[model samples]
Target: MSTPAPEDCGYPSPRPRLSVEELPAAENTQPIRSLEDLAAGTFESDQELEEFLAFTCAERRRDVA
Candidate 1:
């Protein structure tokens, strides 16, 4: 018997950019453990969505830098 190719199984055949060793992790950074972290919230309008996106982007930029 023969095994199917990655494309046949719905996976990309090319090698990914990063190996497991290259993954980002440290004592300060950890996976999300709380259910509330994945909670679904909504914005009432486009302006509100833009504001939320801008705020979150700035916060993440500061965090990663």
Candidate 2:
């Protein structure tokens, strides 16, 4: 079974869209927010990366529920 739409729809008619210049400026978009620099460090052992490759899939995925 199916139903048919009326000849007139979409709340009778739609209003004209506002131009960009006429639109109000958003507060969040005003200024660029600064982000803190991330802390980075080298591995304790140069071979650490190579050793990690030997770890099982379970070991690679930490804090599993």
Candidate 3:
């Protein structure tokens, strides 16, 4: 039997194209001074800290990409 095409193999289709304006705004850039400042309670809550980390990771990915 013939193999099914990539789409017909049950994988989800690619995401819809989005215009630059339609995309989410980039995160605010922060200047990290030291490891102590990073470890300190700069963020108010756990959620805020998580968001900061996620933003940092996204920025790094974009830079590497």
Q: Pick the candidate with the highest TM-score.
A: 3
Clashing pairs in 1: none
Task: Score candidate 1 by TM-score against the native.
Answer: 0.36
Off by over 4 Å in 3: 1-39
Between the candidate structures 1 and 3, which one is better when assessed by TM-score? 3
lDDT of each: 0.80, 0.52, 0.78
After superposing candidate 2, which stretches have Cα over 4 Å from the reference? 1-7, 10-12, 25-65
Pairs clashing within candidate 3: none
Give the number of the best model, judged by lDDT. 1
lDDT of 2: 0.52
RMSD of each: 15.2, 12.3, 13.5
Instruction: Quote each prediction's TM-score.
Output: 0.36, 0.21, 0.39
Over 4 Å off, model 1: 1-41
lDDT of 3 by residue, 1-65 (tens): 99877689789878778666655544444567788767866779999989999999999999998
RMSD of 2: 12.3
| lDDT for each residue of candidate 2 in 1-65, tens digit (9 for 90 to 100) | 75544435444445557667555453223333444333244457658856766565557576474
Clashing pairs in 2: none
How do all the candidates rank in terms of TM-score, highest first? 3, 1, 2
For residue 2, what is the lDDT in candidate 1? Answer: 100
